[model samples]
Target chain A: MTLLKAWQMPIILGMVLLLALFLPQMQLNLYVQMVLMYVGINIILTASLNLVNGYLGEFSVGHAAFMAIGAYASSILTVLILPRRWGPAEALRVVPLIGPELANGVYLVPAVLVGGAIAAVAGLVLAFPSFKTRGDYLAIVTLAFNMIVKSLLENSGDIGGLVARLIAPLSASLSADVLRLSDAVGGPRGLLGMSKLTSLFWVCLWVIVSLFAMRNFIFSNFGRGVVSIREDETAAGLVSVNTCQVKVLTFVISSFFAGVAGGLFAHVLQFINPRSFTILKSTDILVMVYLGGIGSLMGSILGAAVFTILLEVLREVIPLVGLSEVWRWVVGPLLLVTLMIFRPRGIMGLREFKGFLPKEEEVKPQAAPAPP
Target chain B: MPQPVTTLVQQTLNALQVGSVYALIALGYTMVYGILTMINFAHGDIFMVSTYLGFFAAAWLLGLALNMPPLVIFLSTLLFAMVGTATLAVIIERVAYKPLRQAPRLSAVITALGVGIFLENFTLAVIGPEPRTIPPLFPLVNLNLSGVFVSTIQIVIIGVSVIVMIILDTIVRRTMTGMAMRAISFDKTIVPLMGVPVDRIISATFALGSAIAAVGGILYGMAYQLDPYMGIRIGWWAFISAVVGGIGNIRGAFVGGFILGFVEIFTPVFLPSSTYRDFVAFSLLLLLLVFRPTGILGRPIVQKV
Candidate 1:
């Protein structure tokens, strides 16, 4: 069968949609549901990150920063805009475009999309540097951006009050109270009072969307250009692939999806701190990407699901043995190390699932080869 | 006018002290990068573990003994910490890194990160989350220089760091072993043809770098309160310094460390608080990389087709 006739993507999408709608009915309790939600979000984060780390061959250590941007953006929007309770009668009066009736149900979808878009814009800042640098330097730049974002978030506040008055107009206030009204973000203590909008349904939905978009993008002309650049930038450039453009595009798209994942996480947990989006979180995503197998999208989803489940299982099982806390820090890193040592190519290498089975023409050698 | 001058001088000394520490750690980073082209992500955690070793030695081993003189106990504990840390570091390289040397850079890096996480969590589990008090080994004597009050320990930290750096510089330039190490760093492929024992040299490099980090860790514990998480922030700063100075250059690491330390210390004085210290250092690093990616003293890395 030709690549065009492959039903893998549609089948995967349909399976995901069905799972999203019905997985909650499974015998698993709320705790299990929350863990699955987390896994779904992580799947989005890891899969998107693999596009850059695996497919584009660029090392970014600040992927969590984009997630932070998305989380903060989505949370702020939800806090400021989402109506707490809208009855059927009142909901119709306030909500624009969709009116009060549909607003109660569909309002979240737009907010989440906007949150992802905001993260993509933030990603552009880091992506622009990829025009010149790659590899370790790119990693350092991303790490720096991560620190910068964290510090900025930590110090963001109003231009008044005791601490604020001291620095005043010259510097941003670090105190939360001074900027209470103006500051959409909840500086230092982090954004709070966010609604628990991230359900298993929403997370799985975005995970499906993120995976589908990335899968399609990878097989697209643009994705091929990215792969070409990854194989050899000089060669790609000679062949008319704009290496810089591809790099920036991949970074932006990856960051955008990472942000959406972040939004899902923030709403699910209903709390976020600067510590939540540290280099540790970035490492977590990187581990998932590498453990799943770098360039394989299916591997990323599998990796994220496995890691999330493993983490939850460890949390549940380790404490029972009286070493619960110790297990948290030890298990993840140990698995990563073991994986690198024993299976550095991960569960899969660069090859996707489609590459596993022989083509119909290959199975039948007498058949004429398909045209390019 | 006097106030500003005094503040400036004090900040400068503070920067020097911090920079000296960064320089000490950056040496380990630079040396490892120089030899293997692999960032030992575990280097920071190794430093963290060494600090805990020093802490344990000072608080439990030496601090308990009443018969021994304070100075002797301090000296012996420092030696023990350095040796223990060096051994741990060398073993890690031998077990974890040596096997992956022929593999991709990512494999070694991931393994290093794994080692780092393991070390950190192991310390956390063993020592508990509570920050252990590092009993002050050196007496806290203050010397008023012109007007600025300086502690004897701070001076000692600066002095020991400079002396060690000088010795290292001498070893690298004047000694045959150092010459061989340099040759290997330049091109490992040709070193075997030159009859140099490349594996031994690489292990020696790891031992030397780890030993330096252990010393730095001890001094760091003396300067500040010891904690398991201490290595992370300082490790990052040292990495920034290593990059700032030019990654593979030893002298550059020293220069970068001091420059970073001074910038971090003084920037807080001009700015609002110390919270932005990382931002400032990293921003400077980014700007420098944007302008001169090779770093201040680093030679431009030429890529092979």
Candidate 2:
């Protein structure tokens, strides 16, 4: 047991290094490399959402909004402020004397962290409203927040234009090119010329870190308090768990990681739009959290990897049936519907793998709780 | 820009027409939520299926047209869509929700969402993804009532919705099945002890809700093109309306639908462009929910100790 605790992080780190540093340099196709990066990103996303949905048992259907915020926040940074030699960010590159590759690498950590910080703040703002909203009402509020963010992004051109006009006179130096004001979000055409700063290395690093963080949190006293609250909020309050503080703190951390994942997504795709972060995207992440068995860190990791690979496999299956890419979408929902019917608790269904996680973790009474 | 008075009246009429469709669809959501305390996210897709049913019925009727009136053809399409969609709803409830009745609420919600995605994709795969325009049921006739020009289509939409709601209200209030439904919603265990067949009543609820939504789908089809994914956006709005009206309260759905309709239609007027319509509409939803979580017409139950 001591050996497992002592060496797990090192072993996982070594594997991540191998995959990120060595795998890319090896004889692998670009498609495979991209899928691997996405798997890493999904791992981060699923784990973060698992904190709220799995651990806290809050029905937040608007997680993608946080991701959207992170994406735009980081994308705008990379586009408008990062080193110019990379891409669209060149126009506003105030610094010099750094090599192009080294500059890109150096710029990524802060940009992504900034994204996480911004999203975490948004989560903090939402925490108060969430205290008043319970059950399905909370779900609707989150979903609305998501739509509000998406629609705002979609109309970002006009809104940006309005703001530019309002602020341009005050600050004479803030030119259109300086602000990249002409087409910051591209107004539904999506923003382009993003610095593809997302490396397999960064993704893998974050995924490992997030997993370790989540696992540790799950095993902590604070996590036990969160779980008790999920099991029964009123009961937990009676035991003096300070459920509200736990909920807000968990939400802030979860959304912060979600933002980090979104930063990865933007840099990898080299572009982003409002369309990419819809309620559907949130639903996709939710499916992973639920499928893996909520509150199980390892399950979230497993679910992300499996779901990502399943998507890739479905892509391969489409051409074999003499159909195009859209058919893959059809197959996915069909599979999900069937899977839910047979295994509503999800593929993991609260059954955690042993050793690191106890075997019989999540499989406690499947019956609905008594009416509140 | 159009004249203020003219635009005001026109938008109000338009809101009414749109609100009627929302009311019809919201009823389905409220009804299902009342009985099961589950959202039945696929309720929107069931409405989508009804549109296709309307399409095929119209095309089939065209082949046998013996100088039949347009109104007659429209009536048949409504009938076909209602029956077909109601059956689909029953199958969905039986397969997706029935087994998970005792599971955690999240499980049921996920199942419903999966079912909705399944229904949407299945239709898209079968019929191809291009939006199909349904043939206009009748020629558009504009009537100017005190400088307000309301089209026949608008009148028909509002007219049909009211009639259906009346029938539904009567069934819920004045029938044996309705009593069983109410009893089940209140206390399923005791109702079963009272010898009421709970399963059948639930199925009947599905049938009724789905049928009303089908009528909504047909009206929506007459105004807009038919697409498989149309249910998703529209379904969300109706769900919001249901919640805004107080989810379990039938009357709440109707009132909430109109309120949402006015907000959605009018927000674009005050805003710079219609792009933020959803943003504004949903913000309004959040505001309303903040003040009154149970909705305007919904009753709150005291938490059991």
Candidate 3:
């Protein structure tokens, strides 16, 4: 017990590292591996949403918009930038310096990072709207943003044509290339045929990094500013918190991780579509955030894990009860409603697991001056 | 080609019909938001469910084979849907919303979302994803005035919506229950001290909002096929209408709904396809929020320190 209290973080992290590195190589069922990957992706999503919704106390229902941006940004890079014949061996042979197995893995890192960077830029743009609004009004802005993104993606094909025709009168070659690239995105039909590069190790690594980043941010001065904004925005500004800067920074950081998760999600599915990133998908992330608890890192982790596992379990168990697969969707919402009614604050609320956190320094007793 | 004036008049007629349906649903959204300052996200789903209720009721009436008049069947089906939907809304308020009145505001919003999702999926599970429509309550007739053609259904939809709006406006302006609701919206804490039954008034608000939505459902079902997921898209559009017109303002919602209807129909005329409808509508909403956050008819909210 004493040893664990002293070195719990290192020990637990080591175990996770070992599991991530070896789990894919083990002879585990493919289904179980997929579920684990989903768990990791969902954890990243839940944590990012928590930063905005839970900590900042903003109700953003359009988080999937950023995810869609990240997914498309990364997918376009991996599919278009890479050579036509995409294989680890081919990549390694082309690069020649890196090992065959690690070649694509190394390339994926930059692609995902680029995706996050672009999503952060998008977040920066979105954060400006938050400056002028709060609460449900802010929610409307996010919702409109989501719809606009989806519709824009759906209309990409037409946009390309319109742009090409307009430019055709000016420059012929540029118009052709623009049209080709627009069609390549697949528009409403969806982008397809991306290689499955999202391995268990990479997913687990990203999940751990996201968790650590969120925890560090929450403990930092800016994080306190975020919480204070949630508690009372006027008061926080009165105290010279530079609330606008903090809010924008928080939005960018939160959306950056959400984008990273989107890249991972795209690779796992090996396909990308505007339909995948809708209001419904955002609601799924919100459910996970609220399920475990709000304003708690441990809660986000647990919430993501439990919600994902429960979904899988219901998918399997519903069939046994003589119900169709669609019943799972019905059951999921019912559970959420029940949870809200019974425990409005969620499982963890604002509390963190004591064991997971380092001990606070014990206050030493000073010599009392006889009932002074 | 037809005269441009003919096309304009024809489109305007179409827009008015669509706008009236949207106005009905937006009124529901604005009413709930006005009374509780909470977005009843489930209101859209309630609208969807009411359409289904109307569908089943019409189907059953036609199956009775009683040689009844179409107007009687329509009115009875409308009444059935209103009562049923109002009951559901009142029950939802009591069971789901009442307990969380004192909790964080977002909790109620989230719960409303959950309830909306549950309603959609439950309807899907029971009715099996197949879209259904209410049987025609009256015979279809086309009316030609000058060069433009209009249908009897369009006139009925527009006329019924206007009548409902006038009735609702009068109720809010003159009735005791409406007065209590307006008072509560002004100051929730003190209204009960003045002998208003806050809980019952709230339930009445939910019931009234839901009843109005039922009217929209029946009209919409007559015009288009009904599906469980139909609520999501139309509900969002109606919600946007309410927001654009100024949430909690009845007249604003009416105008906003018509504006949305015009946007929906006119986008296809100017743009290459109808797909740009959502893009135009949302852009309009975003622009409005940026310029006038209070909405057209809504009073500005004062931030208390």
Candidate 4:
């Protein structure tokens, strides 16, 4: 029991490593690898969103905004700036931990973390007004934030034009620099030509990390405080949980992970667009959180994984059944609506798998007498 | 650039025409929210479905016409579309939202989103991704009054909207069902004990809201064109209008819709960037929420410990 508790995380990480090592050897189709990579990225996104909407019981409809920020930040780092300064091989040079594609992704860790840090700051700024909102109102405010983020990014060209007119007195070089930065964003056409640094291994590794972090945190005292607030804010405040601070912290952490996922997505797709991070994108993540048992970390993993795969599979299976391709989009939401109507709690219904429980033997490690 | 008075009149009239439709959609949103305290996210999609209904109704009417006047054709199509949309609303409430009534608030909210997605995608499946042009429901006549040109369709849309809104206001103010709806909105759990048929009144509320959505749909179609995904953005604006006016108050919706419509229209006129329309509108919504969280006419609900 003690061994199992101590070894669980390492075991999970080891499995990810082994999968990474052998996946290339297996010679799987590139499309299949792409699907797997998507699953991993989605798992990270959905799980982080679950942290906000499910665990903290807050409505954060602007998660995709954080994702967008992260994508831009990380992509700018690895694709636009770093490659120019240190060359494409700099990433491989920094940490050649393995051969081929494995080492190719080594530099993404720092870039992705930087992206997460920036997004966490954005989340903090966004959460300032959320101190007053509760439930439905929170949902609306977050949605507005999503819209604002999208519009702001999409209208970068207009902003560039406006700035040029408004700051006509500025020195030519400085104004040129400002306009250059705006142009780099690619406006509505999207920023492309990013290096494909996101490997199946990197995504899977983060998926495990997100799961581990979320689960462990959710079981900690801080996580308990958040859950208590969800159950009753008044009672949690009476018990001295510092409800407002917890809410902000939860949002920051959740946004950070979402940022990480966004960075991975950016590198994987080798493209980023403001439109891809729309209100509908956020809704898609929300659907995953709802479909998964809210507040269950494992459920988040399952929901993102299963839903991602099912979507790809359904495209083929749906048409085979003599239905139009429209059912591909229709069936998912139809299932969700019916599910919410009949089983609103979702598949796991707030229950975690038994494996998540810390072993009884590990709880009193020093106190227990050894068998020897 | 300063516009001539005539052009200004034309712009304001156009604003009013657009605002009337928004008011209608906002009313549906406000009414459902008044009773359920749920946003009814699918309300916009319901409005979208109504346009298709209007299309079908018009086609049917045109086929079976005995040289029917345009006004008569429009009226019959509007009525049939309303009934059809109202029935859909009732069914959606029953299937998607009703069972989750006793569940968590978020469940109902998520279910509402799911219903909206289903409606949108289902419409996309049924109607291919093409924007349908509604045949002119009224004869084209540009009425020139003091150099201001106004289309006959715009006048009919505004006039019809005013009449419908007045009737709805009367229904809510004077009818027994309106009083019952008000009672349910105030205290949903206790209303049944007061001998009100809570379920039936709730159903009636859905029907009323859906009917308004249908009217809004036809007007929107007349003014613009129909697309499967058109409802989401307009629906969002209508929701904002409902919130600004006081979410649960019927009068507030109309007031809010016009405010939003004018803001959206005039912001681009004054500012060089038309893209900032959404940015300005949403900023206004956030500002309103911060100062008067309950909305302009909304009554605050005391938080229970």
Model 2 gets an lDDT of 0.84
Residue runs of model 2 more than 4 Å from their true location after superposition: A1-5, A84-104, A167-182, A355-372
Model 3 residue-pair collision total: 0
Alpha-carbon lDDT, every model: 0.81, 0.84, 0.88, 0.85
TM-score against native, each model: 0.91, 0.92, 0.95, 0.94
Who wins the DockQ comparison?
3
Q: lDDT by residue for model 1 over B241-299, one digit each (tens)?
A: 99999998999999999999998888878888888787788788888988898789998
lDDT of 1 by residue, A36-55 (tens): 88889999999989999889
The DockQ scores of all candidates, in the order shown, are: 0.63, 0.65, 0.80, 0.73
Report the C-alpha lDDT of model 3 over B1-305, residue by residue, as the tens digit.
36999999999999999999999999999999999989999999999999999999999999999999999999999999999999999999999989989877877888899899999989999998887778889997888888788887898899999999999999898999999989999999888999999999999999998999999899999989998999999999999999999999999999999999999999999999999999999999999999899788888888888
Each candidate's root-mean-square deviation in Å?
4.2, 4.9, 2.6, 3.2
| CA shift of B107, model 2, Å | 1.3
Clashing residue pairs in candidate 2 (N, C-alpha, C atoms within 3 angstroms):
A84-A90
After superposition, the stretches of candidate 4 with alpha carbons farther than 4 Å from their true spots are A89-98, A164-174, A359-372
Highest-lDDT candidate? 3
Indicate whether candidate 2 or candidate 4 has the larger TM-score: 4
Candidate 4: the clashing residue pairs are none
Q: What's the distance in Å from true for residue A331, model 2?
A: 2.2
Whose TM-score is greatest here? 3
**Model 3 lDDT tens row, A1-372:** 878668877688878877876776787788998999999999999989989889999888888998998888888888776544454324464676754335657656877888889988999998897667666887898899999989988898999888999999899999998797678777898877667778787888888888888887887777889999999999999999998898888889988998999898988998888899889898888888888888888899898999899999999999999999888989988898889889888788878876545344223377466874
